[model samples]
Target: MEKNELKTTDSDNGHSPSETEKHLEHGVPVDAVNLPDPDEGLSEEERKRIDRALLWKLDLRLIPWLSLLYLMSFLDRTNIGNAKIDGLQEDLNMSNNQYNATLTIFFISYSVFEPLTQVLLKRFRPSVFLPVIMILWGICMTCMGLVHNFSGLMAARWFLGLTEAGLFPGVNYYLSCWYRRSEFGVRAAIFFSAAALAGSFGGLLAAAIVNMDGVGGKPGWAWIFILEGLATVVVATLSFWMARSCSTEKMDLQLTICQVHDFPDEAKFLSEDDRRRVIRRLKLDQQSSAEHEEFKLDYLWASLKDWKTYTGMMIYMGVDGALYAFSLFLPTIVQQMGYKSIHAQLLSVPPYAVAAVVTIFIGFVADRTRMRGYCNMVMSLFGIVGFAMLLGSGSPHVQYAGTFLGAMGIYPCIPNTISWTANNVEGVYKRGISLGFVIGWGNLNGIVSSNIYRAEDKPRYKPGHAVVLAYEAIFLLGGSVLQHVLLRRENAKRRNGERNNWVEGKTEAEIEKLGDKRPDFLYTL
Candidate 1:
């Protein structure tokens, strides 16, 4: 009788128990047309299903590799700063001002190409496109070892920027495809900490390579370029085999690509019978790629119309200008502290090490506490004071201490700012375009940093210090204003119960179906 009853139940629902199990595991709506409200109280099976789905999303393999890619990308870009102490300028016959100009030139190319790459990612698979660019840049970095003149150094610098142009923007876009908006900030921090780690690692690596200065009749700077470049190439080649394309990307996918392959079979919490009923109710067609159908230029139009885009651009530019200034010139700054060249390179390690730990810790904490704006404001204030202490004091110990505090405190907030944009933007294309534009355009400050520290101000580059201080002050004030504007808009929206034009077409009844959705999508506060 029991066997007969089981058979009857199986026949009633089209999905087998295994298929239902799969659906629940993947967070596929068991009843596809309308997902049940989590607050309505779930059946034991349904609760188990949600738990499994969350667990699957937290897979460990994805995090480490993505973090490594970011690490190498950042390390390769800034290792040039470490190279300066080991005869880089002398070998290239670059004047002090010419050296800075080369740094400026990299940003010109970087800024111009980033937005173009975002458009291109829509057509090309990231697994292939990103790694190819990585390999190419790695090759360019290696060539820096061979450069013997100002023009050679200039050419290498431009190509370095051109090849690396899409890395951060592309990676940001790529991560968004995998993780939902709520999860992006912490992940973004993990990836961005690679920049901080690179600072420390580059210092250590340079210290070791400087020991090779007289061994191969090559200057220590040449070894720095050669070894780091080769490392980049090797890592890029490996990443080609390891990195995953987006879940929907078809044809030429990597073996290691992370994706939920069988939504129906994976959901275990919903009964097989219930799951089948749900599948029958959903709007999705198994054969269709939602990404292709949903792709639109609407986001580009909306973002352009929004004043926030320009405001975001200014904020990014100020933050990056401050960062790149320190990254490219810290060794020079330390040289003024009376350390030998190699010793200066080694000393760069401690500040960045502290910065890395502080950045990662604070990023996750702020994200957990949901305090993105406050965290950023605090970082800007710290930077302002750090710069002030160095500018006003003559004590080498105090200045060094100020530099470390500034580096540690200020660095964590920039990525949060980028992640803030990622979380708030709704459309993929707009996210891509905005990210590319902000990152690329912000690099313009590299030019300013390059020129600010002229040879004339060797011991104290008073102008350079003053320039950054001014930029930070403006950022502090502007950031406060922008936060206030966003808060006011959010409050007004809540009070008036008005949806913007973006959400205007959708009925409130329809939008309310997404229970956890933040309709206002307020900027991080």
Candidate 2:
């Protein structure tokens, strides 16, 4: 309701917020952690070296475990592709409609639950909430193994969708809480690599697990669910400890209080020095005083009202339509390429494996160059070319090669887009909502892709390939070109002081609340 109609109470100062926020970290007590500051008795060179080491340590503790969680989440969600080829349809006596319904229903719930899960993730502890829901989903997957009828299968899938919805968006917000924007693309890529790896590993594992078809009188499809689902439960149990402070965190961008819930003194893994350095770095990197902000409905509304959120949604849709369709049907597609079911499962592994490596490589490139948009666009071209090969070529070998190119191009764009969106935002609640909707709405395309790859379009499913290719083209233009150009122009306007009047005469607190809109906050390309 003020002049700009966008001010919050935190933006009352006339000076840069960081200048005043140097020591005011997100509510972590200095004395509570019981260790000396890493800044003490150190030169700048020494301090930088120590900070680098600390980051590596944090990487070791965080990325691998989180990657595992994502791997399981992706595997459980998409492994049905493997199950379908392995006799789930014949064993369950399902018609084409029934099977597609299962896939469609899962995505409907998956998409619908994502935004709500994001809000809940913000309000609760990550360690408790993420793991608990993971356990529930694991149970759903395990129940999927036990389903003897159509209604039972439907019920299990619906619950699985609900419970598993929290993990992806929740983890994105969680990673954003710790890493700076410059470092975020790489971390998100690494986390996403797990999903790529899941596709590869899922195929390889399915080839072997299917050999157990008659073991305990259970079909291969049921065991795939039972075993993979059980593995998630086991991992969920370990997550309570493996995730450490990550699970208990509130996306606060500071891990000051450690991992032991309300007890700051109990987190044994991170010494006081590490916690101090981490919190200090966050204060420097962040634009807002998150310590002063709380969850408010207004923040959610602010995120929804932003044009960037919808832009991100459409951009993410560009690749996800291909990603979900391709991943969900790769095994079947391979089977249709004149291979046996077992060989199809085996062949599906390499494309995903290549995709995982390319995804990580592109992520680091985006980080080092800070060129998120260009990286996304360039990589997307690979998929565009690949999908064309699949649609135009009649040769099985050429179509098969297209799968690798497609995976390579499509997988990396996901993390790049997500990190770009995150980099462009400031403030906790707004950031969380943006991530949730961007990802959730993007997932709606999964339904589109899944349905298009219908039973009627076997062998060279020309329609499906064409649809994916179209989306890839959109990804290059809308997701990459438009976003890059817009942000680049916005940054130029700020640099030229054209938007300076928005911040003029505003107190520092009011200025702080302007977030990415503030003249000083440069948008990442």
Candidate 3:
């Protein structure tokens, strides 16, 4: 209630009294960004309008551009496969082993760089940081066309990985800055479905681009890399200009889109009252008020100590193992079943199309129901049953149908699992690292998926099918159920005031720094 009293309370809590604590009273937090009550005296109608406008503007401004950014990332990553079929190996005189080595180098670079890039994501302006990396990778992709030997191509792939590593988890963290937990799943699904879009349509795009053969004295395969890489560069360039708000860059006093996007406190497009409304809702939703905490080394390692983060990663690994293995071998498996090479490629399209549609539907439902954990379990069962049918049945029809179930299972499970972790984690810095670690490390499941389907095991690869089935059923489904029970129990403990030690004898500002560990902060189930 008084300045002298505030310092005495904070000193007892073993916290030094500072400027931030001076304004904190008994139970009220002084916002990191000082403001009056954001919604005070507003009519119910006005509050509703501010909420609606914020979501609509963000959905328009953020989702589509992010989807395209991710689309390009997926295209550049996978287009190497298309290049090989278009005579990349023949032109470069590359051995099969050398070609395989090129692919492996990229993954190594990409996986290792993920955790570090998330730190940079927190430090820098995202508009500047994200597009800069896109340009770097696009240049790397373009250089592949000019390479004349195996070593040249390998070098380009490695750089491409280093540059592209940040886009996936970075976008997930970026969206969290603007969207509430309830709104995240569908946007993530839409953003992730860009991979499905790339898988389904990238071949067609490559086919058209490669037709530029001899137009610039390069082979068709070389043109594929050259043109696609240039396209990524062009789109990334336009994103900078689009950073000017539709509300108009000329609007007085507010920062440009790029500057405001650094944090909601700086939103150029939102009216002053509306912007504070956005920040207030987020603080309320998280049940913590440590807005704009300075970056600290402790934030990065905090996620490492949280068991929930590892459980999320292990569960995600189960989904990634099944997803990648199926994607890699689907065409070959179909070819072995007596279809022509081209015919199998065409058949592969339906599975991806089915996956893309189902993944979007799952996101909308997960947000509305808040049953994300149950959704993951249900989806994993689809994969388990799909793999079971493939292993047990002799019918081509049954095996063919298994592909659909597998696609449906793994695609939707990915977004649900990702958003599940994103939903529960609190604090910007900790979330940045948590998502980066969970996604970056989970993708290392690629190693297992890559190996399980040995060449000798083709034409109903029983070993691969069995291995993936166990991963999905045991890890994804089981982990989802386990987290649900644990989180529910923890929520009850907090609800019953059994966790009051966390808040006792602490200044409100010190308590605000607790993030998700605050007793009032319940884990999402």
Candidate 4:
């Protein structure tokens, strides 16, 4: 098809000629619908003003609620560590291995179900799906308080993972739907830093909750589960009113190319101008070849075949393994530093707090510089140094300082890594599957992490520190370098018009089915 003819037909799929003329009056060219350059007619000042307003609206409506939901998710997931120091193991007559097994069981279910849940999230809207799962997981977390034995705790944990499986990947996919690739890092960081803050808050909250040891014939550990779980249930219920799904139908109409499912438009929060500006920018940001596809299993299979998907998964696995182990076992690690259990919980706060601030800072810097791979490598170095300090020193003060370094290093990398993969992949279905697969496989690290820090390796837990440090050096650091090199080489190849053998003479539809492997699709390094 001729370029102009294709553009007109695509535009007619969603927008009328009158709408096209209206956009043209505001400086958008009707024939330039999917042009690589956009905002050509707006003044610099006007563009800045519009962007500021749009960002403010998005931040106000989206970030706080998503952060809160993630905070609750992280709390419910890791509060078991807090409950452990409060005597959960003793009450249930569990050994250290059995307790670790409970943590492992959660990840097993979590890893297995995450991809399926992402599919479900697409079938049901996020507004309906996210809250329903939150309520169910809330019930499961609350039930953990009532469990009297190892089998009961295991059952509660298994179900908790099943219910909570969709949240992280679902949220990532949702953010991708709204933001440009270049603009995604800071927003993702803001959302993910909640997990770090949750660590800090979980510690402080556990310290306070553990004091209710004798209230109403319930132990401190039981109270921790009961109170936090109830809070999640209440918040989930409230989310039914607060959560708004970005209308895919509106997005479809604006893009003129992508065909989206007919969703009820809930864009009342946005003014007409702001909404148009947002949509125009998003259309410009998308690759023209990837613009019109609907959700399909072919997209999923294409993503699975992309080698970058597995490499990204490796990076996520290494970093997430260290993160999960640290969050799940930090209190115990602190207690081993010669402090009482209560004191240990309080001491856990400073590192996480510092990490939270550093995480935000890194996010901003990463977005501004557009250097995710370099940022990831530098952050991984912080973790490597921190672990080295912990293993090298015997002093509590030095060990504590190491925690700060470790927290800053690992926490920032989580968002960067997520955005890194999200930024590179195209197509909604392909992006969804790639994210779900990366996160789901990455979480298997939780299983590996849970087993690494045994009671046998108490006090220093040198083996645990050593294992995490090696992963930081090899996978996190080395993987980023390799990814950067590979992407650069691929871009160079495309610039030279060197198509892969399989791509020759393929129909446009078949080539589009190639997703990220299209010669024009450049990887973000």
Instruction: Report the number of the highest-TM-score candidate.
Output: 2
Q: Per-residue lDDT of 1-525 in model 3, one digit per residue for the tens?
A: 000122233355665544333434443445523455567788999878868877887776677778888888887877776666557878899876676677667777887888888878767767678888888999998998889999999999999989998888888887877777888899899988887777667656755666677887898878878887998888776665556433544634222332224556665666776667777766646523224668888887789998888889888888977877777666656666777634555666777788889899999988888888888988888888888887777677899898889888888988888888888888878888998888887676765665676547767789988998988988888888888888879777765556656677777667767777766566778
- Runs in model 3 deviating more than 4 A are 1-39, 84-98, 207-221, 244-247, 250-261, 287-290, 390-396
For residues 271-382, write the lDDT of model 1, one tens digit per residue: 4543443333221211111133234676566667655567677777777888888888888888787889878988888888888887887778766866666667778877
Q: How accurate is candidate 4 locally (lDDT)?
A: 0.79
Please, what are the lDDT tens digits per residue for candidate 4 over residues 438-524? 999889889988888989988899999998888788888888888888877876775444644445666645654555565545577
**lDDT (C-alpha, whole model) for all candidates:** 0.67, 0.79, 0.75, 0.79
lDDT of 2 by residue, 245-310 (tens): 354334342342222121112233557666666655654664332233578898888998888898
| TM-score for each candidate, following the candidate numbering | 0.80, 0.88, 0.86, 0.87
Model 3 TM-score, all chains together? 0.86
Off by over 4 Å in 2: 1-41, 241-268, 287-292
Please give the distance, in angstroms, between residue 137's alpha carbon in candidate 1 and its true position after superposition: 0.5
lDDT of 4 at 417: 92
Ten-residue stretch with the least lDDT total in model 2: 1-10
TM-score of 4: 0.87
Q: Which stretches of model 1 miss by more than 4 angstroms? A: 1-59, 243-297, 500-522
| RMSD versus native structure for model 1 | 10.3
Error of 3 at 209 (Å): 4.3
